[model samples]
Target: MAEDRILVTGADGFIGSHLTETLVRQGAKVRAFCLYNSFGTRGHLDRLDPEVQAKIEFFTGDIRDSGSARAAVQGCDTVLHLAALIAIPYSYAAPESYVDTNVKGTLNLLSAAKELGVKKFVHTSTSEVYGTAQYVPIDEKHPLNAQSPYAATKVGADQMAIAFQRSFGLAVAVIRPFNTFGPRQSARAVLPTIITQIASGKNEIRLGNLKATRDFCYVKDTVAGFIAVMRSEQAVGEVTNIGSDFEVSIGDAADIIAELMGRKISIRVDEERLRPDASEVERLWAATDKAKALTDWRPQYAGREGFQRGLTETIAWFKDPRNLAGYDPSRYQV
Candidate 1:
């Protein structure tokens, strides 16, 4: 894949940043599509090593803009669409914004790719789209129930991406990953919220519902799945899950993290941190059989291994005074 042209939208975000770096390492000529901002921030892309930054072409624009999305997709062999508002709590506050960005934005990308003749489009999706899981191991055939606005918009966006593939013969595959976590994950996520707080010398971790369970995958593994999907012919026009089959409740995950960090912390249920009853995705576990059968991809890291790696890297980042500036430990992010 060396020297192949690729574009990764949401390149400045948690998963997007990791995927962007992975592509660059594989010798792809990468163009990172970052969201535009007046502050001129690149998000996690700015945190990349200086050598990696030099190799990338950065395009700042909204995915909702068809013209800009078209311009970015032109001449690219693969398009990895990852840009969207991802916070479930925030989605409740502004659903219209989510629709415009996630749904309409995907529409723009699909239209652009259809027009430009992009060979493969790897659309990023979240496991939250499955809601609280009607089955233990959720498969692509599993019914979707959007419990939150965030998941609802993703469902809409994902459907549109698939529609283009079926209607126009666009080579598109949806890569739906379960909870992906690592160093650059935002504070809004449960893992980061706990890690950042504990790393900052707090003896108590304030969290929302701890009974809810999730299937967590390290960012590296999730990014690798993206590459595997992009290269596999069977993956084209398919919706495949990239995740570990196992799951852990939020409370257990917190306990595990605390143990890894050697911190004896008490968990406090924060009212402001809780998701609305209707919006909460109480359980999310994935079945990766399709991905395994199609692309020969499997998760290498289990819960303990993934958690340890995440903790070590996250602790290192949070321990740095400069790196901790953006995160506000004093206030609840949600």
Candidate 2:
């Protein structure tokens, strides 16, 4: 696997950056596809060690553009498609962009991978596609309910991947992860929002939907799951879920972070932070039986101890002046 040429789309993003680094460390020749920007930024990839950065062949392009997507997929044996418009709030404001990027962008990759005959094509999906849990532990068989436009686009993307596999025999594997969080996550996410606020010396933590519960998996664990899915022959044409079965409410998660920071903080319900009631996902708990059965994969980080350790590492990163400077705590990112 190390000698295989791998292309990771969205290689500049939070999870994508970490996955790229992991692939490089394991001795794979990686081609990283980052969103083209005027400032020539590589997003979180710039934060990786200089030595790791040097090992990757970087390509700047938009996934929505067929020519760019085709160029990146041409020589690669494996393609991990992670690029998409991910923010739910932003999706409400701009649904067409989501369709173009998430739906059509995915179509671009699927078409390219099929034409190029990539050995493995991994498509990234989110638990948001499941919406609120209709049952205690959401599995691959759970009905997909797109409660938000962002989720709807993802649903379309996931189906497109499946369609490609059935119609064109594309070697596609879909991995749906539940609430992945850790260092490099932007403030738009709840974990980073709480950590950044507390690290910035805010006494009152502003949040929304405290009662909402989620199964939070550390970023490393989430990346590991991706690797597992990529390697397993059984994973081909299958949608596997990668998550810790443990669940925590938003209010309790905040309290845990405060405890780890060694500071007591007041919690405030900020109206702006709340999502539209209908758009909110009330609960998400994953059932990893299929992932375990198919790939011999199990989450290394689970429950309170894992959560605390991940939070500690995340808080440390956000506390650094260099890193903190990149974020504006005063403005609500979204």
Candidate 3:
């Protein structure tokens, strides 16, 4: 059998860039679909090693454009759709953009993949769909509650992937990862927000809800889960959760980060940083049994060990002036 030819949308973003690098290292021919920008920027893809960058075929386009989406999918055996508006606070301010990018963009990819007879379509989803987690350890069968416009759009996109699988017999699999964090993550995310602030040598760390719990997965492990899902024949038309299955409250996580950095910092709750009462997701804990059963995927990094390892790497990156230049630790990132 020949190596799979893959198209990774949002290949310039945090998780997408890492996934793209891994796919290239694994000997898969990768076509990276980065958003078209006036400056010809490739987001975090520019941070990748020169050799890894050399191996990828960069395709600059927008997912919302049907022509771009179709062109990106053409002649690719597999399509991993990761493009979207992911920031919750930004989603609250601009819901129409989320619907356009997450919903409509996904529709375009599905249509193109189906039309071109792509062998596998891996749709990226988020644990945010299970808002607040009605029950502990959210399973694949758990109900989806869109607490924010971002989550709502993802829910719509995920259902559309399923619709294509059933309605058009398209080979599609959905991977819902919970709070993936590591290097190249934007400050909008809690982990990066905290890490950047700490690395800036701030005496007080400004943050929002400390009580909100999350199941954090290291980016590398999350990327491995995506590959496992792609390789598993049993994962087609299925939704799998990629997570560490370990929950950590925002407050506790901040403390851990401080310890890992060997810095003593005070946590100050910033009113401006808090989400709307109703929109805030109080808790999220993923159940990975289905993913393990279907894809034989188990997280290599779990619990405190994983959290420390991931945070250490993230802190080291942020401490460097070069990597730190892109972020503003003083401002509250939306």
TM-score of 1: 0.97
The predicted structure with the larger TM-score, 1 or 2, is 2
Which residue runs does candidate 3 get wrong by more than 4 Å? none
**In candidate 1, which residue pairs get closer than 3 Å at backbone N, Cα or C atoms, i.e. clash?**
none
Question: In model 2, where is the ten-residue run with the lowest total lDDT?
Answer: 302-311
* Per-residue C-alpha lDDT of model 1 across residues 204-271, encoded as one tens digit per residue: 88999999999988777788899999999999989999887678899998998888788899999999
List per-prediction Cα lDDT, in the order shown. 0.89, 0.93, 0.93
* Model 1: how far residue 19 lies from native, Å: 0.8
The residue-by-residue lDDT of candidate 3 on 276-299, one tens digit each, is 999999999989999999987899
Residue pairs that clash (backbone atoms under 3 angstroms), model 2 = none
